[model samples]
Target: MTRSVSALKGQDTQLNCLFQFPPEQTYNRSVWFIHKGKEHESCLTDEPPLHITINYTERFSLAANIKNGSCTLGIRSITISDERRYCFRFYTNENRWTDKGGVTLRVKATPVISELYLKEPPNEGITNNITCKVSNVYPRESLNIALCADIVPKNETLSEQREPDLTFNVIKTVVFTPSKFHHQKYCTCNVTHSALQQPLLKTVIIEFQYNSNIAVGVGITTILLLFIIIIVLLYCYKQTKGKGKAMSMSSTLPTNNAAHSENAVEAPSQESQTEGNIVNEHFEEPGLVYSEVEFSQKEKQNNKPNEDQQMHMTEYSSVAFRKY
Candidate 1:
């Protein structure tokens, strides 16, 4: 079986090889070798590939199925020294001729910082920018870029880069203003490689402010003024209701006084009628002094009793006394 190792480096990298041979050469045995610097190091060679090293070993392994004519090489925790050309040799039981395949290994290192910038600052009716830069990236690989803003209408931008150690700047510009409704919003920048987008390479957050204190003060003042106005209006309403009640009492007093005065006049009239009745009763009694006096007076006047009796005695007496 013949196999070729891929040119890649990592903790656990798979080396796969696919091949086809004549049925007679089916008894071919495979041998995998790792060449470091200028020396050839034997890793594994057999009909069924063998795992050459332990788990703690920095690097070693090989697996082959001579029946299927396929083999694979697994290297654990690879290092820079492991980055080299690998060879796979296939030999038949009867013949000594061997077929070989080679592969070049490349190591990937941690990403480095490239660049960072701000597009714009948050302002009234203005757009702001947030940018990030990354370096030492793989060529022709998709890059995951994101821009985050703390303000409303959060926006995100994603793109790709196709070069080694390329500088990628993702700019997210947001338009907003400082208002009473807004919270403390800021801008964030993130740069990620497509292979490992979960862990970000660079992240930055920028805060923008414009007279936030003034806006807060104004809002507070407006609320206070409204509260005061409400209190004043309530006070005025209570005062008006009190005054209406007082005025209503004052208006009713005159009618009450007039009715009382009428009642007083009627009561005196009733008393005067009762006194006249008593005087008549005394006049009817024979041998009563009051009756004799009245009879003598009537005779001296030479007036008929029936005609004089109907006249107002109090008025005639008052006139007579005045003449006297």
Candidate 2:
């Protein structure tokens, strides 16, 4: 049996050899060989072949499930030197021999990481560009690379280009605008190959700054609001003070007016007392002269009176003179 396998470099490769022979003719005995440089190289036999090359000794192994008539070669971490053709043969004690299909092992080169960048500036409302590239990918295999954004917009997809296996770094640029919707958006780079369905994704986050105009406007508006509040406070303070003063005046004015009226009435009473004394003195002295003439005539008529009656009259006249 012969087998061949093609795998990317630094990857594991498996080769299978299929052979069919009569069950009675061939037992479980099988021999696997490697042909390199136009020479047959013995690799493994039923007794475990000895003195294998250093490159194949550790990483190469064989599996034979003879019941299924199949042989498998497993190569781990394959390199360029591992590329070769292999052959398998089955032998039996009855002198019967059967050959299996040969195999060719090919190693493909691994792709290289290319360019990576952000699509746009790290500011709000600006379009950002994110790019990722890989070089030297196998052309025979379908290469699917994707650019994933942390925020994937509807109806948006990544773009790609292809070239032959020689130094082809696929460049994909995605345009994105930073927004509140993409507050914590992440940009990712993905790569897919024929053997792997799930893509390998690399993520990067794009940070956006707050909008300066909005911040400044908010600050200015806040200041203006504060200023208006202060003015209102001052006006209210003045109004309160004026109201207090008016209240105090309205309560005290009636008491002051009543005190002044009481003092005015007392002043008039004092002035009237001084004028009454002056009028009484002026009337007392002038009234005696008119009555004197009439009294003289009455005295002449009473000349014949007794001595005792005359004494009483004299006393009465003296008292009256003093009282006046």
Candidate 3:
């Protein structure tokens, strides 16, 4: 086996083996074996007509010439499963030999920064997790993932192992406490791999939001509660005032009824007395009186009488009195 090689997946690579023996000895045949976990599997047997295993029949090829004393194994469109150590064994005439130090082929794939976003809604005064996802990376141990907030490192890296494809999905998370000062700030995700010439980076703007709707809802609820309390107080006051007025009116009702009865009885008596006085004034009659008197000789000397009417006559007088 030649020197070890680091090859990218989905590319072509070759392994060469060279050996020297005595001039009398001639090269017979060679076989290549791949190292599995605890065993080795024969991949190709290079005899006269180079034969390969069922798995490598399509994409595996070999070129060898005893004159050049070299055998090269070619692989096309390498996959992650092709990452293993390959050993070469050969038999020359009567001697069998094998190369113990096999060639190690390391397959790698570039890391792709697929997404960088917040795992939860960013609310002011709360802690949130920002996640960065990297996909399709091979040789998971070679992946270097990081998260940054404004160029400051704050990250915890985790990876998910996938089967059959031998690829990995990496997740990196950062803890952030949102505040008014952090609005519109940026967070970056960086990924590096042996297959990549430069680090893959993804930047996202973090926007923290205020919980104004919740505050408004709480305020409205408080106002409604206060208004209900005021209305209840007013209703209770009105009911109390009405009850007091009712008690006062009930206490005064008997006095008012007695005074009304007394006035009703006295009104008829006064009207009847006035009518009796008018009748007495209309029926009253006038009165008359008469009196007789004699005069002496002294009263005749002081009085003068007509000489023509002085013949013999009797003295008489009449008087009247008024009735009221």
**Winner by lDDT:** 3
Instruction: Compose the digit string of candidate 3's lDDT tens values, residues 116-184.
Output: 889877887666778888888888888887686463323355657585678888777777677777788
Instruction: Specify the highest-TM-score model's number.
Output: 3
The residue ranges of model 2 lying beyond 4 angstroms of the native Cα positions read: 1-4, 9-107, 112-115, 154-165, 195-198, 263-324
Alpha-carbon TM-score of each model against the true structure:
0.32, 0.46, 0.57
lDDT of 1: 0.50
lDDT for every model?
Answer: 0.50, 0.59, 0.67
Cα RMSD to the true fold for all candidates: 17.5, 20.3, 21.6
List clashing residue pairs in candidate 1: 49-64, 119-129, 120-129, 136-165
Error of 1 at 261 (Å): 11
Error of 3 at 292 (Å): 55
By lDDT, the better pick of 2 and 3 is: 3
lDDT of 1 by residue, 260-304 (tens): 667442222322221122122133344332321133433445533
Clashing pairs in 3: none
